[model samples]
Target chain A: MSKHRLLAMFKGFDDSLPVLRDIKAGGCAGVSIDDVDYLSPIEHPDIDEILERKVNVQKFTFTGAVFGVTFGFFFLASAQASFLVQPQGGKAVVPFPTNFVLMYEMLIFFGIWTTVFSFLFLAGLLRKRGTLYSEKLTVDQCGIMLEVDEHKLKSVKEYFKKQKSIEIREEAVT
Target chain B: MEIKDKIIDENLGWQRINEDVIRSMDAPGKYYWITFAVCIAMVLCAVAAEIYQYRMGMGTVGLNNPHMWDMYIATFVFWIGMSHAGTLLSAILHIIHAQWRKPIYRFAEAMTTFSLMTAGFFPMIHLGRVWNLYWVLPYVSDRGIWPNFRSPLVWDAFAISTYLSASALFLVIGMIPDMAILRDHAKGWRRKAYGILALGWRGDDRQWRVFRKTYMLMACFLIPLAVSVHSIVSSDFAMSIMPGWHVTTFPPYFVAGALYSGCAAIMTLFIILRYFFRMEEYMTLNIMEKTCKLTFAIAMVWSYLNIIEFASTWYGHNTYDKELLINKANGPYAHIFWLMLFCGSVAPFALAFQKLRRHMPTMFAVSLILQLGMFVERWMIVAPTLSMAHNPHQWDVLYGSIIEWAIVFGSFGWFSLLFLVFVKLFPSVSMYEVKELTFHLKHEMEEEKEAAATSSKSKAGAVGKPGLEGA
Candidate 1:
């Protein structure tokens, strides 16, 4: 046997907490807190308390924005100067106002795309179809997916059962 | 107390919200078919008109030298202005955390992207040579020439593409959660379709966290981007030395006008969606009143800005500006100008009446009037200025020919076509957000009841005992 993958589903927000705390407290032998994942229909800020690292998407957003502004300005300056060899209506070769407008748009344009892609990546979306799930999870139920060793599967299942989980699913890999 | 009614039906459970919203995506009714068929016919007519115009050149649509920026540009601005409805309800109201917007924002966001798709066509249509349109792009060419980025036309190209891209992204990204809900519930080919669009969303705590952040960040970007876009559109006229078009207040005026038209459009769609989908629980009368209030406020802002533009023209004493202003009031466009002023400025006062706001049919008529007013305002902006420009020799009065009018109506058809297809394919109301709103309002209502019960108990005890330590 390789490892036991299990999901515990609960009907209420607070109902998921005790099991989450059990894994976080290291009370569950052969189970790692890092392997536990939470599934919810809505945002639960309390879920962040158990995770070691908070999701940091704004960094990716800012980096993309900075890059967009830098690239946008330079491209406008260089492109206008190198090509428009003739005088432009006796005005500056590259005007700042128009260029600035495009640059600001680029900042948002780049920032939005980067945030979306990074969210897709960090959230582990578009991964191989998840093995353990319930239709109820996306509706009223909350799901917690975790990996456990075969030796500890029975005990963890019992622990989840004691909390009166609405449902429990498992995929054991050999 | 009726005014304080919950925005969505708090009595609804999570599963009910899902079922109701998903049911809206089921087979549409007879009215939908009739309207959709009309839209398809309009689009077909427009396509024929465009083909004729393309073959005969822009002149066939009645474009003389003076009326070059005719109905196409004004309709382009109209569609662009209509796109702002989604931004107003989705982006601006999102940042403010207006829960009432939850049920309606999806359709508004869809309108934003689809109207943009429609608006993008006008510039291409207005081009004398539509095939040679890529020359406006800043790409490297065989001739070693580049587009003049200094032109406000160029600014428009950039602003529109960016606005379109971001808004489209915003619309799709916001739909992911709801798509996942549909994905779980749908079957057969529908499942596969929604599954692909759902992007493997599991609605995990982490995904929701990142989704919320990304949604907010995008909303933050969209508001200013929307403002900047209309401002740039204003510059297409303002940058020109045209007497009536060069007002400094044009940007704010345009933005205000865009929001006013956008809000009115939202009301029209809101009533339609509510009636058709039986989404009365979500699109409640109280919420409609709130939307009416917001629209009334923006209409006032637009009216003030209109006055400011006129007052500036009167005081500045620019001979050309004053003469053009007088001509607009007394010239060929005078009827349209006064209609715009009356419809946009005066008619919205109906919203201030509670009975009128609560009456759906009255509000619907008012919304249509506001749209007509905004359309006239754009026509007045473009037509009168060009007709009475600095050089009188280039002056020509243009009432759009049949071809131009046909194309304008067709754009509306195209937008409706997209919107009709979207509602059929996707849930017009956001399911998860409505569930969340229900959750919040339920808790608040429960807390209020509990508070009321506790107060009554305390008062009863005090009446019997004359005093109590805790009381």
Candidate 2:
């Protein structure tokens, strides 16, 4: 039978671990197997069964590739226009040695353009809601969201009931 | 949290400059006025000389067939060399992660733009028929006069233009935020002037985003421009069949020499600005020491290149190249060449010691000497080669006439005058970046302080607080 809420008794031993374990074992089925919930000893081996996921956001890498492309295109275009048109002093049109100068210039120009622009774009800046990041996150905090349905709400609440120290609160992504 | 705040903190090393700038502007003492007057007067003299050159034609300058380049081309090279200061300070320093570069980047960029403008003048004036200067472009003509792309001269024109535009744009982009600050602080017509230049900047994230992106772009653009500009300049000499000018390594050698001299020039300016503007607090000994190290390192590279160049000349066993190289060390221009070696190499080598690098007076003196040595090097490069041209029968030794000397002197005056005027008009150090860096440094310090406090209060406080969550 599905249970609504289970209020297991806990004291000392930093209550969070047993509460977390209950949630993990309970499997959001709204049922608790043990009847008389009591405080577990600090050295209890059952706590080892609890699992946690590790996650982190990584900084975006700047490639400067687009910058290179823009530069290459510009230089190629400018080279085709200037040196590639008429052969100079009986030399072949688009003299490879000389046109390399234009290539050098374009690479510089485009590389810079890409590096700067990409940094801005990747930083999530200049958008409508830019600069609106939660200031509190700069200090100490962590937010872990657990999805719950109405059918399992009782079980989760009961599990959290044992974790009185955790300061659980309802939240929506809105 | 924000990069801007990170850059604006108190110990971030900009408080002294901020205070000194305020003092200089408000006080305007006797020496300030005197310096202003002298700068203005010199600027006027340069203007007069330009007008005179225009009226009297290129004949007024001492340009002959064999030594056609004369002072103008030498001055062009000199100014171009000077322009390297900005790119080295701003772009290269940024790339290499030199923090001291923050305060000096703007002025360095200004140096690039203005020196380029000055350098551009020489080519026009040297052409004599300044109006027909457009004929150098690749255009269809009845005479079928196409610019010789093989000629380094044409390449120089393109390289200089591209570099000048890129540099100017970079400078303007970097200055926008600071211009906004200036606008806020200014009154009357000055406010309006700054307002226009500020480009409606607010400290919004969008502007900052674009600004940062553009700045990074500029840095990326500038490094290659820096290398290419000097390489093309060297090409002007190398493409020639002249003995000393016909080396394959001239491109990189010239680039190194340009950067060495450029860094020294920037150091000299930094020293002058520090004392004159009472900016010692902002431009600290730390910055001086770091820049001196850079200067010293580049100096060493230059020394190595110098040896390599000479060694190649000897190894090649080309009679003409060998003779010219020996003559550089022991010929008619031997004294100046030796002096160049002593100042450019010997003086800077002493800076290898940490103590010597930190000594302000010694550092300044060395920088000045290096600049002087570089000038002599440029003169030696141009003059001695022409004097020892192929035809011994036509071996007319080149000497600077009074007119040539006047023009050279006038160009120096012009450059200084423009710099002085720029100092008066704009904030010599960037206020926005300084503020942003200062703010960030302070915020980080506060975070550290808070962390320490919390740690002491609770043994497990840090773990519970979730450091770097989703970082």
Candidate 3:
């Protein structure tokens, strides 16, 4: 089994800020932002620095594009070179301009595909449900999800209460 | 009113935007059923036409000699061009942070993907043996003969497939948050479907941060990809050394025309979605005005390029090019050439008038006219070039047989079919983005109200005691 998770809901983004802040200052039992998950009706980019830091996914896009270019160059060049039995007119066996076009397309193709895959992986999507969910969190409410040890569940519930969270769901993941 | 005030009506809250868009996804009513039936009937007609054409071969479509590329290729080009507007709105405007594109961008992006799907059909329809389509793909075969990468047609294969993959990913990625909303509110099978599609999106900070970055990166790749896609499409004509088809200016000209036609399509769909979905608050007159202004600008650019091509051909004293241009004006296709000019160049002047542009009915009519003009322009490009391609012995005035006509008209039905199904299955508007727009607009409104209150208080205070009352 996994750890116990606390799901706290507030009316709006602003209402959820202080609890996120207060909990950060007070700290949990070896819990940090990595163990914390947020749910909301909409995007809230503003969060206490201690609670969450923006994740980077651009490196995957760059690596994907580089790989695409290298693969495209090798694949297209070798195909052209293999067919040197009958050269078409005076044209070079492997022309740069023609191969470059496909290479450019490949870069964008791989760049977007890699970016999307990395985003899905890093964001913890397409997996078994790990956090307790509430429909209202998607509708009009803001949610803060924090994971902690089993013994510390009561004190975290108190933290949610201190901030006047409208609804809270406590669940143990296995 | 300033467009800032009009982006989202003050009366709308986040919940209203969510519920209203979700309500739009409810089993569509009688009119939707009627339109859907009509689209199906048209597609059936097209399917029957394709079957007949397949059995009887290319002769049925009047594809002979130099006239091998006719209505199918032209319509393919037209649909491919049509896909550009979505990229303009969804990717370019997104990168630039054009907030006005928010409400209308979802449908426009959907248009990009659907039009590309529709456009992709033409090459297959044009092919004599459709089953050999895999010959275009690079794979290990015992024969060892690869597709000619030297050909622009092969470049097209690469560009279109990459374009299709990138735009489809962009559309689905952008829809994840909205899908999550639907998953929560949805019931039964729909809930499960959306649950899988949403990929367990909780709008967590990590998900959002990564989503924002991923979306922006795709947008960057998409803009150049869009330009390259159309430019490569133009190369199918421009790379050919046949008189009028050989113009150096063809790439930019085609790009301009693509944007022009796409913006018009967006206008037509914007009105339909607004009226059908009852999305007045979200779609808004101001966005329509901005769209009209953009379309008009692109139309003018297209017109200018048309003139430049004519002038360069005339001034360069290339007898072949000049004669084709003249024959286009005076030959059997003269009526179409002039109508293309009138619809593509002249009719767009109506958009310059603010009164006509903002009124939905007039804009709808104008958008349809522009589409007609763009369609005919494609016809003009293919027919005139073939008829006047340098060799007098080979010249022939080709008229499309009924099979060709059915396939051409059927494409519109095919597109409408995909779109109708998509609108019901998906939220045509972005829910979370609208919430963000409403959030910003609310703050801007509050600031404006506070400023107004302060100004009024100062005026009232001055009126009771000071001499400069009304000032």
Q: DockQ, per-model, please?
A: 0.72, 0.07, 0.72
Which regions of candidate 2 fall more than 4 Å away from where they truly are? A1-90, A106-174, B1-29, B43-62, B138-144, B440-471
For each candidate, the alpha-carbon lDDT, in order, equals: 0.87, 0.66, 0.88
RMSD of each: 2.2, 12.7, 3.0
Across B255-291, the per-residue lDDT of candidate 3 in tens digits comes to: 9999999999999999999999999888998889999
Pitting candidate 1 against candidate 3, the one with the higher DockQ is 3
Every model's TM-score: 0.96, 0.72, 0.94
Q: Comparing 2 and 3 by lDDT, which wins? A: 3
Give interface RMSD for all predictions.
Answer: 1.3, 15.6, 1.2
Ten-residue region with minimum lDDT total, candidate 2 chain B: B1-10
Model 1's TM-score against the true structure:
0.96
Model 3 chain B weakest lDDT span, ten residues long:
B1-10
Instruction: Report the C-alpha lDDT of model 1 over A1-174, residue by residue, as the tens digit.
Output: 678788889986768878788878887776777888888887676667787557688999999899889888988888888656686677888788879988997887888789888888887778885467888877888988888888888999888888788888999755
* Native A-B interface contacts kept, per candidate: 0.71, 0.14, 0.80
Sliding window of 10 residues with minimal summed lDDT for model 1 chain B: B1-10
Task: Determine the backbone clash count of candidate 2.
Answer: 21
